[model samples]
Target: MSTYLIGDIHGCYDELQAILEQVNFDSFMDTLWLTGDLVARGPRSLEVLRLIRKLGDSVRIVLGNHDLHLLAVYAGIVRNQLKDSTTLLLEAPDADDLMNWLRCQPVLQVDNQNKMVMAHAGITPQWNIDTALQCAREVEAVLRSDSYPILLNTMYEDMPNHHHWSEELSGLARLRFSTNVFTRMRYCFPNGQLDMICKDMPNKAPEPLRPWFTLPSLIAENYSIIFGHWASILGNATPEGIYGLDTGCCWGGELTLLCWEDKKFIRIPYAGIKHW
Candidate 1:
């Protein structure tokens, strides 16, 4: 059986299907790991969400920032400008089921048997794999609880980039920190402060502010880390033990899928709109 890891789909359902065809994906025999951002910014968000949900155990998906934003929208915690672009999803007949499934998806996933970990963005330099998993569970528990609607109210925002995490952080602060690291994070300071404003290519994020995977604290990691969420990298990052699979398909680049067993990238070019 072959295992595949795909980058962010961002509502590019056609491209996703093309890549699956390229890989000859067999739902019964092959497993797919998605780097999240399953919906948003493209033509068919609802279709993409339904297709992945239909895949069931054949797929593993971690939540991405866009996915969380969708949850916040569905929960009535916030109204996004993307309302026009996302109306089809929010108004879908199965919207509640889709949103519930999405919120329940973890921000971090650990596959010890495969010796790999998956997060939508990248793990904090402050966390080792085990600690990261524990942190994920903390957020997941809250997401799965009765307080989830209340938590969504505090999910959106860029301020308060807390570098150090402690058990002392409960309520909104802790959940936001966990959300940022697992979803919105890309670049970070050496001291682990998140750089939320910079979404450009790695070299353009300003010096001293490095990609999260390059942090000195993470140099000792022995297992592979798979992530998406950095479309600007366009699947070009070659950092050791780090895999970036977002190829910017929503912005006219290619959809990328990596065969876990052989590490071969299967790319499908976008044939639709060139700019979003």
Candidate 2:
């Protein structure tokens, strides 16, 4: 009954299977938590989505930026990138079912019993746990609604890149901010506004731009925050209670999994096959 948390899969189905087999994961018993980006960038995104969907109730997932992009592409809100490997998934027989399931997936998941919270990127420092959860629900509601394409469309519209969270923000602006924080955020300004551009490692980041987790926040003091999206970190050492699990498996790095109860990490190296 171990709970396992794996980083971004990014369509690396073979490595995902290898790591799961190495842990002897039993879908009927063991619980698996995924950091999302379940598709794109690898050889077998269709297979990856199928496998995770087949895992059923044994798995928990938070939607990543890539996942949202897949939804937008599926809805014809945006075109699929030439380099994306999700075309097979889009053409699959169950594409509709898979996309519906994915859109219904929340951007944030909290395990009260385990005292942990997970998002694809990470929570903003300006948001307390309650506010974060509320904002997540707001976006999740939109994604799960019939008007979901509206959100998928509006989220990509050219707006101020540095729109800080505010109690007064409403409508599409509010949903977009919440979505970006949950899926695209990496760094924050000293005043707590999101820095969406920089993806460098913390030390190399320009001055005053700190990793979101490094900022002082109420959630960091209370529960372990698990996230992916910044593959540059490559699952390196982070501050206590902060877990950056994306090991860049799609970029020829390793796929990493953490056994939550014991904090043991299991890593499976990429096979170095170029899928894109």
Q: Enumerate residue pairs that collide in model 2.
A: none
The TM-score, computed over Cα atoms with residue i paired to residue i, of candidate 1 is 0.94
Assess every candidate by TM-score.
0.94, 0.96
lDDT against the true structure, per candidate, is: 0.84, 0.89
Count of backbone clashes, every candidate in sequence: 0, 0
Model 1, total clashes:
0
Top candidate by lDDT: 2
Deviation of model 2 at 20, angstroms: 0.7
Stretches of candidate 1 off by over 4 Å are: 82-84, 161-163, 218-220
Could you report the Cα RMSD, in angstroms, for every candidate shown? Answer: 1.8, 1.4
**Lowest summed-lDDT stretch of 10 residues in model 2?**
154-163
Residue-wise lDDT of candidate 1 within 102-202, one digit each (tens)?
Answer: 88888887888888889999888887877788779988998888788776777666675554567687767888888888988888877888877777778
Candidate 1 local lDDT, residue 72: 82
Structural RMSD, model 2: 1.4
